[model samples]
Target chain A: MLRPWMRCSKNWRAMWNNFKSKFLGTNFKRFMGFVKKEFYHIFRDKRSMFILFGMPIAQILLFGFAITNEIKNVNIGILDKSKDSETIHITNRISSSPYFKIKNIVSSEQQIEAIFKKGQVKAVLVFEKDFGKNLKSTNLANVQIISDATDPNTANTVTNYIQSILQDYQREINLGIPGREPIEVRSRMFYNPELKGVFNFLPGVMTVILMLVSAMMTSISIAREKEQGTMEVLLVSPLKPLQVIIGKVFPYIFLSIINAIVILLLGFVVFGMPVQGSYFLLALETVLFILCALSLGILISIISKTQQTAMMISLMGLMLPIILLSGFIFPVSSMPWPLQAISNIIPAKWYNLILKGVMIKGVGLRFLWKETLILLGMTVFFIVLSIKKYKIRLE
Target chain B: MQALRDITFEVKPGELFGLIGPDGAGKTTLFRILTTLLFADEGTASVAGMDVVGDYRDIRKAVGYMPGRFSLYQDLSVEENLDFFATIFGTTVEENYDLIKDIYIQIEPFKKRRVVALSGGMKQKLALSCALIHKPKVLFLDEPTTGVDPVSRREFWDMLKRLNSTGITVLVSTPYMDEAELCNRIALIQEGELLVVDSPENIVANHTDSLYKVAAKNTYMLIKDLKDFKGNKSVYAFGEFIHYTHSNSDFSEERLGEYLEAKGHEDIKIVKARAGIEDVFMALSEKKGTEV
Candidate 1:
């Protein structure tokens, strides 16, 4: 026992020492050390390296080209038996519509199958004999549109485009003619007038990449420590649970941001995608979405005991749902009602809505506050859940 | 249902304490509990005058633990791994270089090499260095020499001795009974219960029996015949001989020799033998097993 004043001074010294040790940015520096080790892990491991850098580019290219769903510059063959002015007029009309390029004129019907089998042409237009004479006297003419049915969707889209072009020609020819009426249905698709799938895929691919790079990579890396038994060592150290979680998650935030930027840049430059809303809002929302995914990743890591289990859960659990329920590939509205309701709980679905609002729809926070709040709420929920789920010891 | 039962022991400051047990003798379980990495069901444990559960944060700061498995990052270079652990513990390697210099220097030549490329001995040295980087007051090592070569195991024990002399309380567990002799005191644990706790010399000294090394040509049959001996108290087979202890203190070797001779044994060599830590361990374990 000592005098009160002397005891108070000793306590003061102890407090200062504690403060200097615990605070004063030592934790920050230690957190940085953890992050530095994480970079070593990501850089030295080829699987993480590839997913961190290569997958974004590959996915962008894949979605940009493979599933474009646009009908542009499609080569087509025309078999004209009539050799009349009307037939020539229709052929020129089809060629100039920007949907079809007349590759070659087939003289006989047999050549149509030959070109299609050779994969030279996607479709062929065949006209019957005396086509102009029949249209003038009988008020009717038949033209058969034969398309390559290997890819049924592309074939259907091509057929629709050609049919629309033919209808446009008929409307132009029948305008103001006596006793002859051809109904015209003019439909306009807003925001994307050319009906480019790239516009849709920009957000879709962005959603998928952010979810994967943030969630899957983080979970796998964390599970990797558990498998390697370094997690036991980490727990035994002076590092707090918060420090470990943030240390394990912060690098991925940085990397996922890089991935976000890469996806946005590719979508903007390569595919001519637009960022119609505020760039600040876009970046903020991107980070929020990334945080949501990172927290989900932490939750996944908490549940998994091994890297293989984490990978399987990420791929089978996260990827398919993010790709499917997020409306990245298929429209959520078209899905069955139960699935549509289930999509509401998916963070990707909400992030997809926000991304489309800001990037494609050119709407600000005023218009997208609901989706943004939903995403923010989901992020908070996941963070809270993961914090609850995290283990403080090696149980 | 339980990993450790009624296990109790204390290590004085600066003592090299050893937990001697077989593979599944709850050595790792006890270590984990003391390190604050695990919880006990029925009892409480403390480390460095702090409760393991309530003051776990403080205990974590004061102790350095090396798990049974190799737990360092395999993909990281040796220097990088050391730096990483030092940093996470809120200290730099240069700040605590003197603490681990003895062990770190042995593997420093391979500092830039990945841990996966290092040999088992070098890895153990590096692991010890990493554990010591923070200069913890107490060190818990679980099976540090389980897979190491004989020469490296000897060198590792020497390092542990040096570290212990530096005023760090070392609590190490090993399945090798011979290594227990190197410790200042050893606890023989088996099946979640502690059998005995004493210095290695005292444990062997307490084994008061006129032990004899009896070997014959038919060694395999010797095990059965020796077990069938009515006067035998304990019979454990060592590498070249079967160590035997008789119930009677001053049993005559000539009478045993005559009995074996009548049993058609040749090249029979019966001579006195001294008990080691291993023999004591086997005898204690067997006694415990039979009692249970």
Candidate 2:
């Protein structure tokens, strides 16, 4: 009793359903298989696993505790030629500040040279014979600060700290005098009021660790297949080139996410660094950066024929630029014009900006949309280039 | 540099085909093209009745390739490697267990061991098992026994023969001429060109010259003396004797004996020898060189 059209439509629906299941079911299974295999490869190699999980924590601790730019407790030799009450008071004031630790009270200039030569003190502060008399008679006291210029950065910082301490002491002495209070520049440091170097470096460290782990790991892995001749087998399989790339990179994405989390936790617990913004926004930015880095890795792998070449390229080409130009250590505003322009193209620079904006500035998507878009664009560009290069090379 | 040039041959379904060549003979290049890993710049290639370039997806599903090197994940265990390949092919190990069971059983006890720890033969066996996991209609093995021992090489060939019995066409390439005899059909290649394509027996039968094996007190000196002999076309040492071919069609044993005697060779033995695939290969190579 059924019409002919009804039977035809029923057959058509059955064919469509069969095709959908066959296509999607097989692809999903194959992709899952690839991802599982990748995980096995990662987990079985203890060395790589250690690098993946342990390195971020170690680096965070190392950067937080050992490597610092702030000066604290610098040993300084004081040459007090006058044993007057004023000189004693100045000496006490200098020693009382946390920035300077007076190692010796030298009686002569020769003693100052000897202490500096022994490398016990970084700088020598010499007060003149009539220090109080000069300040009372002429409203000027001459104090000589001779610092060892061997390490210019430390020497400069030590000298600046002593000068600030002396200025503070002078203000205290002039508190009772009329019209003699120096112009006090009460500069309040914003964002990081404590001036902790850890606050400045943690974001840079996050950027660098994510870049190294995600980019270097992926590039070396893909190039290793080429070196071992396994890429040929994979290419000959039913997996497309893009699928092969995604399969290889899928596990790394998860690892990088874990790495980012570990870095954030270490920064919070060990360094007491703040995450002022929403954790969701921070995570989204981190994933964006990781994708950008991974795409760059794919591009490098497509160009390199061997694992060694890939590794070298990643280190020298990617790591160096990220460290030097991404405002990680050196301020981008201070770099030369050409280098600054070049840094604009470096993906890490934008990522570091986004990280700082979200983590330190507590900004939302409205403030970070530009940097996020740039990173996303770079990721697309790198992926397209890599796919084009891969096709050309394979052909 | 051009790795392959003017290469032309055909392999029938279910035939055990071999590509016999020396090092740098472009055997790997040909296999790469046939497996859809590379494209031919000038000519066309098809596998399983599909164009290599256009129908690569279908070809990939229809073919299984074992590259010239051990290409498995060295960090993964034997079981993991096998399971990975099976899963990627959209099939389970149990579904095609019969195809690879013969080879996989040999390495089953060490299934937990990483591939890097496996011996050379075990590695090749594992690689072969991975390739056959999908039960494709065609299998391409490039230099599977290059570094394998003699005993393992024999066993690997036996495995291939057993697989071929189940109607899977196999294309194997090797530098060893002796392996050519095991193939139903072989193509001898040199310097990226096809030298000959035929059954091993037919190629050996087609050897043109009358060959001789001569040995004396010092085989090295015998080779020198035979090279200086007037009728010598080619003289090379083969294991315990020197295999020599003559310029003239009518080769006389008495002439060679007297020639060796004149050169003060003692304990001289001379006999007619049958040409093998090696001899045919050498002759064809020399012919191509002279023509070029």
Best model per lDDT: 1
lDDT of 1 by residue, A235-353 (tens): 99988889889989999999999888888899889889888889999999999999999998999999999989998998998899888899988899999999999899999999998
- The true-versus-predicted C-alpha distance at residue A208 of model 1, in Å, is 0.5
Give one digit per residue, the lDDT tens place, for model 2 in B84-137.
888888898999999898999999999999999999999999999999999999
Steric clash pairs (candidate 1): none
Model 1 ranges off by over 4 Å:
A1-22, A96-98, A103-120, A136-140, A175-181
Minimum summed lDDT over a 10-residue window in model 1 chain A is located at A177-186
Scanning candidate 2 chain A in windows of ten residues, the lowest lDDT window is A386-395
Candidate 2, residues A163-275, lDDT tens digits: the string is 88888888888897988888998879877888788887899988998998889989988888888877877888887677788988999999999888888888888878899
| Alpha-carbon local distance difference test for all models | 0.90, 0.89
